[model samples]
Target chain A: MSKAERKAEVVDLKDRAAARQERLPVLKTYKLFIDGKFPRSESERYYALTSANGESIANVQLGSRKDFRNAVVAARKAFPGWAGRTAYNRGQILYRMAEMLEGRRAQFIEELETLGASRSEAETETAMAVDRLIYYAGWADKFQQVFSSVNPVASSHFNFSMLEPTGVAALLAPEDSGLLGLISVVAPAVAGGNSVVVLASHSKPLAAITFSEVLHTSDLPAGVINILTGTRKELLKHFASHMDVNALVYCGSDAEEIRTVQLEAAENLKRVVIEENSDWQSEERQSPYTILATQEVKTTWHPIGL
Target chain B: MPRNNAALAVTLPPQFVPIDEVGIDERVSRFSKRSIKKSSKVQALKLALSMLDLTTLSAHDTPERVRQLCHKAKNLLETMPELPHVGAVCVYGPLVKVAKEVLKGTKIHIAAVSTAFPSGMAPLKTKLIETRQFVADGADEIDMVISRGKFFEGDYDYVADEIAAVKEACGKAHLKVILETGELNTLDNVRRASDIAMHAGADFIKTSTGKVQPAATPQVTLVMLEAIRDFYYATGKKIGMKPAGGIATAKQALHYLVMLRETLGEAWLTPDLFRFGASKLANDILMQLVKEQTGAYQSIDYFSME
Candidate 1:
């Protein structure tokens, strides 16, 4: 080909590439995670949150009280089926979720970019979240073995001990972590056969709800995980005080709020897990022991027949 | 007893020659000859590695190989108690408070890289605000990089003023002006940057952001240290020095220390006078210390970097 003809061909290729770039899909708005499905917010009260550099990257719904009620209802419904599943079965399901999450990593990366994370930060956080899911998934079946035992009684009685999940849990994910914190807390609780209601990060909730969609598509039973995106103060106090919530896991830096939640959780004698403001990277991976922390050891003794 | 300033002058080897005496043409030709032969891929990796601050390693590195490295360097620092402490355990900014708490009552000051470190591309007001926030959070020192674009465009006055304003904003906290030597291009410009920052009231002159190619190198550090020495002679005040970026192994840190010892003498060897702004160096130093004290090499797997 002549030089001009070759140049013309290159320009055509460039145009095609530009067109492809322009056709990239924009992110969704106003999402909710409930009953293993990502549903649009009941009301369209969406608002945009800007990054430190003043770029509007994420759209969050001002989740209402009705949204919280629906989420709790869904989680409450999911509790029986999920909690009744055998530990081995739950472990397999969680591992499958991790596999699915790993496959869609680029989607999460784009979501993270929309949430204003630097390229490195977005990749690391997403990878860590997936790794965390796998880490906790491996713990599902092992927790009972690690935390329970068959007891030797003084009398001729059969005694065995086993750890049981705390029914339903409520969590406030960390603001800075976006999807990572949301998934980290939710995955561990669900992997242990407990249902959860999580309040997504206020500023960056898109990724959390998108992750919820992932969970929805996974083989996970409905109502096992419910996510709401809103202000922490508005949702957290209610979750903390909810008598139905058997435990509360709060990922936040504010000392005073943590203290108040710890105190309020006492009302139901609820189990409270607090992750102090820290590099999540430094946190020990969740294991069977982690499940034991939120579970109760149940022991039963049977009298020997004469 | 009066301190002798002459003792602080760095000694050169008999064969060592000044760059000026060697001539710019010769230096450029020599640099090109050495640089061009390397594969672009290898150079990219070297450049990428050079850009990493490695601060996160200080918090989470636990491989036995890594621990051994830390142990070695820690021991050396302990033995040379007279040497200045390494710069703050430069962790993620949130860890600034943790470092402060950990290093409490110790003479070792806490330093945090703020103002969107590695690149001061953020707004000046935002940078100042961040500096103030870090200081408020108990950081004793702040290290910030100059606007590379401004410096490259011969806008030295703007760069100098920015450093001065940051110095003023620092209040009681010390400010370390990072020259980002790899991007500075010429020794003359590097020298000029040192003078500008010193005149602008920088408490110390730092070498790199650990986020730029060719960050902190012996050659670059040697040039900056000489500039600091010269500035000290011209002005009565002595400025501190920090060579950050890609300093992982104990040997590299020791080499830098040796450079400091030979150039600035024992006076500049203290934590107050000098610091190795690194994440991995501390652990490597600690590992060496452990080996020295225990008389056995311990598996590094047991210890978390934090």
Candidate 2:
């Protein structure tokens, strides 16, 4: 090409670059959510998050086992009050969380977009997350009636069985689905009146932190749902081995992590539930059984003698 | 003069200087930031274990619980035979005999919370009676709470006399004067209380009763440590320091150790000079030691609960 033509091409490219730089996006500082506060990881480490096209988007806190340990402490501390709240009050809090999520829809969608989800897919995930909250909110009070049983014994005794929340649950949110999977896991656990410490999707954690903000503002108590940003493999063992954590819920396909969780959870006889499914958007994802997964059945017998 | 007795004149300092709150906080934060690494961290954890006064001062504590606590004080972790047990077993005055039975020939001693314990509302005669009883029951040390009401009334003489009276009653048992710093509500008050306790004959100056709102924070502990340091310089006698309550994490324990070391040097690292009055701190230290020995984190389930 001639010098004049090459110069013209270069000028056009410079104009394009200037136009793109006119509006710089504000980057969010993603941090670990422990007890109800967003703190830089105690380890002070970070992991770069990039778009599918390899464009750097933001930096996420690379939580250490210490962070998970802190989260478990928070979860255990918050367990009694969260579990003791009236079922109706818990339902109301969950619904309030849904309201807060609704108010933050655009932010969640934007975060999803940064994670490289298509615009429509991002909106869908955000909506599903809000719906998941609402769904669990409805079930919070109803699950008791649905699952409880008044048993007939051979003797003249009043026998009844009911479900109770397992204390503090440590969970790994599905690695593939950010907002929706997180809501699905946490809603069921919280609906069953259990406090949860969850490690968010390592590859896509923006929405999880945003969701923690929602939980923070709503009536939900501090430490009811703690979110951590880090690699699942690195934090999985800590999540499983924490003595204070009463339940372990995993939603990932990695075989080694599954095995490790099972083996470590046996130390405390923690309720280990592993549900690895890829399609979170499917109808089968929402069920009372998910709530039951984090609950314990307690039976009582009282003799009816006057 | 007995080597253990210091400042025979017993003249109270004319004025306790007001601490620089911001400066103390900044220094504590700095001390907290020291990056203790692997082998050294393990060593520090062990040292912290050796400094713990495994305490169970609950109102519901039974002889069985006291015995169990003493048992734990003697054998922190059977799996790690080399690990030292906690410095002592602390229980209510009435249960001192139970703990003494379990701790008979071991290096672990028995600390009894006497003088009405968590509360110091009783008459002086009653407190002396309690202290004398605990000593007779074989308690190696007596933890006594000061009268905050009298201190708040500007009755400095009453406070000093109470400490001296309690000390006389303790006789052979070492006296730990708990200022209950949380009730004092100010750093200057904490400093003044520390001076009063030390001048009136306290072997160890403690921060709280483990029953108050804000027990044993770094600022308060630092102020008390500084008081010990000053007393040591003036009289050429060492006054031990015990930061009891709210120090439940290995990291927090390390921070306290750092402060103690920086303030009083390596001599205070031993159980005799420095100690932690805590029921949960021992388990947390053991968990850290286990985590260090085995890369995997620990469940409290594996550790026997007293």
Candidate 3:
């Protein structure tokens, strides 16, 4: 064929490929994470997740209060062991999780594409999520050094304080970021030695569960991280008021609801960390100091005289 | 007739004043002749600043960056006392909250650029919903772009009705209709857009979305401001003006201010009549103010409240 005809043929092939892509069936799946296992809901209730174009991509189970309780219990049970580990060991585990995430980057990108993210956005979010994990992982051992300070007391007692993890935290991941939001909230709390019960993004829960799978595959002990998929109104109230939850971390666009939860947390004086609706792509996200700011330090004094 | 003749006869001998007898003093002409002193309040400058393009500093220029730019601009505005508070920080819908937080408790309002922004290619329903959501997120203003596609196709009614719908959806929040004069390609189209927007209940007529390559030139701003003046004169209702996109430095802001002062006079100098949609211009103005006050150029580190 002539050069022009060959170019026309190539164009024809490209058009056919595009047509084929439009006709491909969208796969749908959903399950809950309880004690490091993907389990079907006891109630068997499922909610349809749709795209901006109104096409159904998946059906996510509407997890119940019982599911939330179970996750919290599992998190509480796992917290002692996970929190007891040395900071270096936890850092290494988080770092390894980042590597595993990098290995499955394509899976996340595919899931994001199904959830309506543009190809470029999906790639950037996936890379940023992995990098965020790595960034927080590095801060795991150093957060204490930055947040902690030795006080110069008038007396003989040496006084120094270091940030301590608030245990069994509950997080409401942002709806826009399917995987990155899940990882952003969970990794920071976990790196600080706090076990988390994450309420997955209602519209895009598949990637959250998929990341849970990655966590399960990693050396993370069962119950150290529990993922529950449900409505924010349904699950967030329980998470906020639960006496056992030591802290609450919420990341979403619902300002009023988040504020209500913050007020509820005040009933027990539970530590509240509300991530404002912010562009995660901005320079504000790179501040390692924010992760340290969310935690607290506990100090004790001893006498060395006689 | 007799009474009129007697009155006219009494007015016959008027006092003669020669040019030399009239003591015309330079100070009298300079001071007592309605001096029309320019306002030292910087209100016109503030309005021009509100329409400036403040997103040039981003790593990648997109709607998201436009949102961040508004946020940074809002933060910078917090420090200035002389500049009239901006009407709103215009950005994409997703970043409305960022501007909301940055402008919390201040007179300045949050404005989101909707209707597909620079292009206005999205469906009208989507644009309306996006505008509504931004208002729901505490945006006090909506800056929507005219559909360039429809405009180019000579679908003037479609473009006008879209602006009307967005204006209605804006509820109590004011709507600033952007003409994208650079894309309009003619002063006639710009004038037509201004008239259409005004007839459609637009609170203000704006220029450019800042995403287009050639945004908010002085010529365009001058034309739009003249249109606003004409519309007001014809209808006896004042319409505001916003010249946005690619306006940065203090000198450019001053030029627009000068234009508004010279063209619209004092009435359009307020935030209600004029605004600059800028992110970085606020800081540059503030930096200049600080230098003028302190007699030294402060380091960039000094403005690190963000």
Candidate 4:
């Protein structure tokens, strides 16, 4: 046969094969993000996620206390480096994370919709989440100046109060709006220079786990934000009690759980910030105060110069 | 065993075979993939806890810090008094007195890493003096480093003599010969060193000085454990194995335990025969045990930092 006819025959065979079978859609395995790496929960236990129709979407890792402990270890290890970075550098890294989130915006929207969000709601939430990251990025360098003050004293000493990152913070993301709530809690803590162990909203975790991808690729140092997909009730007590965690931010309104958090946190005197039913899209939620909530104030006294 | 002149002349047994690189890599990958979950996992973690040689070998380690470590070794899980304590507290010779004082009236033994420690570069006389000083200060075990430079120089006799001398200096205190396997760079050399240390009267054959990279890798550890098994077959003596350093997580500790159990059977399961020379493993295991009982994820923050 002529060369052209041979090519036609090859194309015919390829078309026949394509017609016979199409590749299946790839489903991601959502694992816990600890330190800079992806790890299945050491418990090896998994809870399945379903759509509105109850069809299984994926298996999200059931992060146990061991997983949280490992994440805390990672967060603590990353804290020194993250907290020590120049404010400008941290801002750039946070901005880079925003950029990554923007790039993967469509995937996040799709994930939200798959978990029962309307298209418009998903789109708006995803946009808000990206904007929230950028908001925090800007605050990374400016929050210290906004919160710090030089105090007037009677003595010969010049006293000044400056905000410092709380080292390692435990974050329980709001059980509502995946994209907005996770980013709102995480963005500020990271902006203020604290590393965090964020338990993504169990009912709405896809966006959070997907956000870990944004973090993984961004210039933000590893372990700055460890995102876990698990129940807050089971993990919160350990989160509150862990001695290494300098602060814990809980974003739900459960009275018993709050009491447990308070009681457990007292063991190590960890700072507890409760955000009960707070709307992430509200003006109140977009302030530098959220960042300060995860920070500790250091007052230094300097001798007055002649 | 005395430092016998005739035993020093005895050649290494033929079972000190060359390590198969591909085979070892494959076997280790398999070990890394195996998961022991639930109650069995908790039991394994607790066993691993009992096998820990809680180490603080930094040059900056103070008596206060060592004392704190000894306290941690004894009260590994103070909140849960039923939890088992660590096998021993490992420290430098100078800190042995403080560690012993803190560990007084406790079942936890104090292990001192002598023989010039991480660098084994000091004169043999100085190492001997240090060993005796540690023993005098009430160190129950002596973890001695072999001169790697001499071993790499093919001075097997010198290496054997050095280990023997340190073992003699250890006297009633058990002697653990650290091969610093990272520096050895070859599994064959590690196997040979294991044999030499065993023959030279090391009560325990240890993997690293916690100051070296590539410490207690599964492949290297397996080779040493095999040497131990062979030594047991020949002399009917159970020489302990300590895979010290870089083993921080509970999962890694249990992996070591599983390797030990499958390789040497239940005889080596106890802390007396198979120990983990690890600084962070105790807390990690404690976290796991708490997670098991409480159904909550733990944080190092609530756990003891030391």
Leading candidate by TM-score: 2
> Which has the better DockQ: candidate 2, or candidate 4?
2
Report the C-alpha lDDT of model 4 over B1-306, residue by residue, as the tens digit: 344566345445666578888988877777766769998997888888888888888889888888788777777776788778888988888888888778888899989888777799999899999999999999999988898998888778788888877878888999999999999888999999999998888899999887779888889899899889989999999999999888988888878887888889998999999898887778778877887786555666567789
**CA lDDT, candidate 4, residue A62:** 96
Global lDDT of each candidate = 0.70, 0.89, 0.74, 0.87
Q: TM-score of A-chain in each prediction?
A: 0.86, 0.91, 0.87, 0.94
List, residue by residue over A1-306, the lDDT tens digit for candidate 3.
Answer: 999999999999999999998896766467888878888776688888888789877788899876886787788889889889999999999998999899999999999998889999999999999998898889989888877888887777878887888777888888777887788778888999988889988888888988987887889889888888888887777777666678888886577887789877775677888788557776676666666645777886755464
lDDT of 1 by residue, A191-303 (tens): 77899888888877778877876787678898888888878876666677665678898887688898779777776678999877446665664445556656877898977
Candidate 3 error regions (>4 Å): A1-28, B1-306
Clash number for each model = 22, 0, 16, 7
Q: Which candidate is the best by lDDT?
A: 2
lDDT of 1 at B242: 78
The sequence of per-residue lDDT tens digits that candidate 1 reaches over residues B131-152 is: 8888998877888888889888
> Candidate 1 chain A — worst ten consecutive residues by lDDT sum?
A281-290
- Between 1 and 2, whose lDDT is larger? 2
- Shares of reference contacts reproduced by the candidates, in order, are 0.00, 0.61, 0.00, 0.50
Better of 1 and 2 by DockQ: 2
* Model 4 RMSD vs true structure: 4.8
Per-residue lDDT of A1-306 in model 2, one digit per residue for the tens?
999999999999999999998887776798889999999999999999888889888899999988888888788789889999999999999999999999999999999988889999999999999999999999999999999999989988999999999999988898899999988999999999999999999988989988888988997788889999998878888888776788999997789889999998887789999988878999988999999999999999988985
Ranking 3 against 4 by lDDT, winner? 4
lDDT digits (tens) for residues B125-165 of candidate 3: 89988889989998788888888888788766677677767
Q: With candidate 1 superimposed using the best TM-score fit, by how many Å does residue B194's alpha carbon deviate from the native?
A: 98
Clashing pairs in 2: none
Please give the RMSD to the true structure for each candidate, in Å: 22.6, 6.6, 25.2, 4.8
Q: Candidate 3 falls in which docking quality class?
A: incorrect
